[model samples]
Target: MMKHGLDPGDRRRPERLTRPELTARREAMERFLHVATPQLDQLYNLVCLSGCNVLLTDAEGVVLDQRMSEADAAQFRDWGLWQGADWSEAVQGTNGIGTCLVEGRQVTIHRDEHFHTRNIGMSCMDAPIWGPDGKLLAALDVSSARADQTERYNRLISAQVAQTARAIEAVFFRASFPEARIVVASDEGGDAAMLLAVDKDDLAIGATRAARRALGLEREGAIRPRPAADLLGRDDDMSGFDKAERAAVTRALARAGGNVSAAARALGIGRATMYRRMARLGLGEKQP
Candidate 1:
């Protein structure tokens, strides 16, 4: 903070983005914003009675959208918690949304934990949201300026913020691959959004961060397209793969009206390979 020439006692804040700049940023993050706005609304509906404001900010910690009770709007706006406000750790110093974005995790900066004395009255809880590509995407925050709020209660709200962030990530991931099949890689650590997008050949097209780590898949850019079964370690047992393959071939054959050539084409495979697999799997004799 001192390096940024910030003096906690001075009570100064960074300049917020102008209307045009904010509009441009929103346009850049339109996809993420489109998916997260509705979640913030839902969260607000559940939290409105608690006298708090729910905010969604981009990776840079600039507030893109917010939901607050109209009764407290003027007060929160005065505290710089409104739309277009820049609360990055570099700008605001040791706050909830900004610090969580920087740390890439959940956090709560309660009351006097704020670097600036003017912000000491508010408590903020936050969680970092990751993009479909497994990069830092945004921050979800719930800020309460209510004087009677306690740190214990803030922790409860903190959990809600983190859950909402995961929901946003899952929605964004599914939206990113509308045509692909989404499969749950694991129920464990699913709060990290362990999801995978697979293609027609059962190749893993994309994976959420937790899914990527669990599967030992690609860390950046497009995945190299590994088989989902292989990633799940199910390939160690050919019995399972055979059973699944048998089912797939049977379905394709049925769909093709029992024509081997049509079934091979439908399965996106060569006729020779299809016949060989059918024989190995003890499938019925092939048609002429």
Candidate 2:
């Protein structure tokens, strides 16, 4: 709170968005809201069943969408935890949404952890949502007025919120790159949520957060539109040469509409060589 220039003991109510300001903010997030609403609704239903409220907020912590029963909404409105409220660290101090945005990670602000006295009654967990380009897009948060006042419970809720946020991010990433081929890569003996969007030439155009992490891509948007083989550690693999050969053949075939002769010409290989490589790679020519 001090870094954002707020005293921990500050007792003033946070600023609220005006009617026009709220509408404008919502409009700015229209694309994200549209892509995320279906999954958000599913998560909201599950959380509401447990008497919790789920909300979607932009990167700046402006609430875009919220889900809660009318009764619950009414009771929570007194704390300004509704739609159009600004929960940025600059405004709300160290609450879940605000802290998550600042840290760029999942967080749980339980009870007295909130810097504001008014927010002390609320316990909330939040996860950061990232776009296909690995940019922070928004935050997904679940809060409850009657939350379990236990550290273990807060940790459980934090994990749930993080998982929910990852699911939403995956859906958004796939939707954002509908025509790109999605490749799922996992660590040995472990399931991975990372999804790489590859082009016909097997060039990576985008990736999920998990994919970026697995590939050790530190710079944002740096791995995108690069050779997937290069970024995915194919150079050190035993079958790297064969895999590259197969990828080239597959790309040429796809680009030529599966016409063997055309694909061969595009790849600068004779028809016989194309046929031999295609047979080896298990690709069949399409009749044209």
> CA RMSD for every model?
3.9, 4.7
For candidate 1, list the clashing residue pairs, or say none: none
TM value for model 2 = 0.80
lDDT of predicted model 1: 0.86
* Candidate 2 per-residue C-alpha lDDT over 1-288 given as tens digits, one digit per residue, 9 for 90 to 100: 677777777655556789899899889878778888887788777767556788899989988888888767765687778888889988888899999999998899888889988778888999999877788889999888775556777677778788878878887888878888887755462423588888776788888877888877654665637778677666644376788887788878899987888999998979988888777666764322
TM-score of each: 0.86, 0.80
Compared with the true structure, all predictions reach lDDT values of 0.86, 0.80
Give per-residue CA lDDT, model 1, range 199-261, as digits (tens): 887888999887887778777568888878878665543586686788799989999998999
Q: Model 2 segments beyond 4 Å from truth?
A: 5-12, 147-149, 188-193, 222-224, 235-245, 248-288
Q: After superposition, how far is residue 122 of candidate 2 from its true place, in Å?
A: 1.1
> Once superposed on the true structure, which residue ranges of model 1 sit more than 4 Å away at CA?
187-189, 236-247, 253-279, 282-288
